[model samples]
Target: MSFIKNYIEQQTLNRRSLLLLSAYGLCGMTTAATLGSGVARAAAQNPKIAWSYRDRTNPYWNSIVSGGEAFVRSLGKSTSDLINLINEGSSEKSLSDIKSLLSRYGSEVALAADPNDMPNCRPVVEAVSRAGAYVSTIWNKTDDLHPWDFGDNYVSHMTWSDVGPSEQTARLLFDAMGGKGGVVHLGGIASNNPAIERLEGFKNALKAYPNIEFLAVQAADWDTQKANQVMSGFLTRYGDAIKGVHCASDTMAYGVIEALRAEGIEDMPIVSYDGNPQAVELVTKGKILATVFTNPHWAGGITAALAYYAATGFFKPSAEPKEHREFYGPTTLVTTKDAQVFKTKYIDTNPTYDWKDFWSLGKGQIKYRS
Candidate 1:
């Protein structure tokens, strides 16, 4: 049961097209501006930006990239001007990439990144600040590292509080399982903040439904292929007793679904996060029970935009209230009932906001209520 099929290829192509089209549309004005004196004025006012992420292999990273690109395009500049780097899942690679960017671009670049590892990302953040580049980190970082400590250079840190949303997903999965059966948990990168929070949510939800036993919990490192293998092994060990699957991201959930299909277990309930397009399709088709939509598109672009604007003195991060310095992004639970609505409203519609508008969206406040 290989989950890597034509559908994946087609979907990847579609996403790439959307990204390129969006970039082209937004970058047109920037191209024009660059030919005139406006380029000089804007360059003096706006900072060049960079976005670095774990890897481009996963749809989640693609979403993050798309968001960042969209934001850059919104700034009336070509997305090509933004430095994009993929760490290929290596913390050393990420650190090295940041160092190179800092050395080359210096304070002219504002950086947004989700580090491959929490602790390793700290020195990278510090280095960016030491070089006078504004930095915003999304999704992965040590708790003790705060933006305020690094002054204006470290603009903000945004993450999703996945625990609440994951618990909601767990309840949906449990209900689909009829409250009594064994389930398997396929989590993300072992040390990731969201992975820990989401798994904690799963455990908390399990306390309410003691009848649904947990068969196993394993780290798949957020890889779909790794998840498929883990789920296959869990199915071999648990057999028909496995009634549900909970994965940290939709990418991994796809693999779990494939594993179930291989074992001829189509009726099992599965819940996942990062409501990527294919996962939404599966939910609409009644193949997946539930997933959490993290809106990575907006998250990626907005964080970069905010950091860039702050670096350019559009807004002073130091003047904003303490809560605004670091916070979580909005997350919504996407169930079968509202999956289509979500796709049409957010995923399909594509975002249309000024690149500089992202700075206002932050307003120096943490908006995640739960």
Candidate 2:
């Protein structure tokens, strides 16, 4: 029942690498540049491609924005052409900045944004469509909204199904604790899609390991400092009873780990999601039991590409099926043994992917409970 050991053994035989496919070779620069030229060239105006995210300080956001830049370069355009709308994790700012862009560019825009909150998606997409712009959104949206319902203007929505891999990490943590221990969790924004799903996964894992009691859980808001503060308090309350920790993201795990280290508790089993560079390094050192790699780079770039392609008339969003409109991106579980391989392939050397192969990196449609 030790999922981490099983994963490592499997990885040793399979040589399991990055979340996405192995690139045999890079696409010729010209070949990739010419991909949407026909449709793009036909338009009288160049649709401005823009990407919006929470902020750039976190290495995770930096990688996402980097992907946005790479996609612009593949189009033979300067990275400056990709306008950045940093919401700084504020929903109001997210709405304001997006509205400003819609007003400025009007119909000649292709935008990929994370609304920073699920409820914000509707208004954001509504404004873009009203301005006659093509828009793609990721990670935040209500279940009721559908790209097909809005014709081609609302291009696509992409979010990873975090439950499965998160559950695997939870099982790994519980099993490592010998199936009996008190575990506390540090989560992202409580209402956020991944946060909600990850917590659900942990709860599901508890159903299997009945003796592993969940001590307490708190929202860290995906902030390291907040996670540190919260974990410090958890230490005060639960202390050594907290035998394990589960974080919704690596950033939170970093904080939790530091808090534990400060208290001289180094041997607790912990797992996190989001295989950021630092988190992968921690995994290699056995500081983190396991983490999931969700490829924010591809998420940022493909979200932009989908909207850009739709705007250029390279594809009609209305013509695609619902599954094509909203889909789940790939998720890979990274543990100690395969951590170095993941580091080499995904972190150390940035592997090039065909951004045009958007769905190839995805898993399937985003399913939700009714």
Candidate 3:
């Protein structure tokens, strides 16, 4: 009877030991799981990004999109990680698209945008700020709206001082025309700040040449088709009076050149902006006298990199110089004299700098001149 009791006691002890070991195993697993989960959360906390733009139809926007894609790729991410919302040329659509991206991505996303219009941009800026999403705007903001006004959420604002380049272009155009006769101006969206600056530059250049007359100033809304039609009408109205043409962008200049060809006016000089592939071709062929080369590819990529690095806590915007935060990108005038050199250096040359380097390029914050 005592032996039986001893056996039963031993069995009970063994069962208790097993239960204790099982509990310890479970506790260890729970601890390990908690640690693993924390690591995952940390990875997810890194900032993701999205960008919105006017449309993909234009080569300008394509360069911008490519830059964004390149920047994201530099982070060891796919372009799909950065949401691209194309507005299809509608301000309302752009505003709505931005809101949708903010709603979906929330604070995890940083946005870089060129809003469709000056006034339509405000609501988008406000919406992203309200959602605690970081934003940077390029080339389309009003003077009153500032990044500082909205706190850290509005990261930066970048715009080119188009006046200098435009004036240089105007001078080139006037010289091409032999400082005499009349020319027509193909301006951008009439209300655009860059458009206004460019026009001011053209007028400023005109001050130097007394014989040159501006036959007409028309708004083409930055569309090639509209520019073509406007040029056609101007040709009809002015005929031989038009000796030269000044276009806000190369795309518009293409239209102007087509009209000039239709009218058998190949000798007329033309100047344009945004030295795109077609523009570069025209410049090489001497069809375009001059054009301003604004590195849209660099601008687009750099803005994304800057915003991404800032959002990821790599650099603080507050510590950066005002110029770095919001200022002009580099611009160069490609006149017939230096067209070949410009093409070799900037146009034909493949970009050597990686997209990630863009963030460091804007290390200083931007300062506005009073």
Best by lDDT: 2
Task: Give the per-residue lDDT digits (tens) of candidate 2, residues 165-229.
Answer: 88999999999999998999898987688899999998889999989988999999987778879
- Give the per-residue lDDT digits (tens) of candidate 1, residues 1-370: 2344543445546546644543342342211111111122222266767788865557787888888888877667886776766666778868876777666556677888888778877888777766677788888888777888876778888877788899999999898889999988999888888899899999999999989998899999887778878998998899988888989888888888777777777778889999888788788878888888877888888889778887788887778767767876777888889988888987776767666555444423444433
lDDT of 2 at 255: 77
Off by over 4 Å in 2: 1-44
Q: lDDT of each model, Cα atoms only? A: 0.77, 0.81, 0.73
**Candidate 3 Cα deviation (angstroms), residue 347:** 2.6
Instruction: Report the number of backbone clashes for model 2.
Output: 0
Clashing pairs in 2: none
Task: State the displacement of the C-alpha of residue 70, model 1, in Å, after optimal TM-score superposition.
Answer: 1.2
The residue-by-residue lDDT of candidate 3 on 8-87, one tens digit each, is 23534544553453233223221111111111111125676767775555667767778888778877898767676666
Task: List candidate 1 stretches off by more than 4 Å.
Answer: 1-4, 7-46, 359-370
How many angstroms is residue 126 displaced in model 3 relative to the true structure, after the best TM-score fit? 0.9
Ten contiguous residues minimizing lDDT sum, candidate 1: 30-39
Please identify model 3 stretches exceeding 4 Å from their true place. Answer: 1-46, 354-370
Candidate 2 weakest ten by summed lDDT: 18-27
Each model's backbone clash number: 4, 0, 14
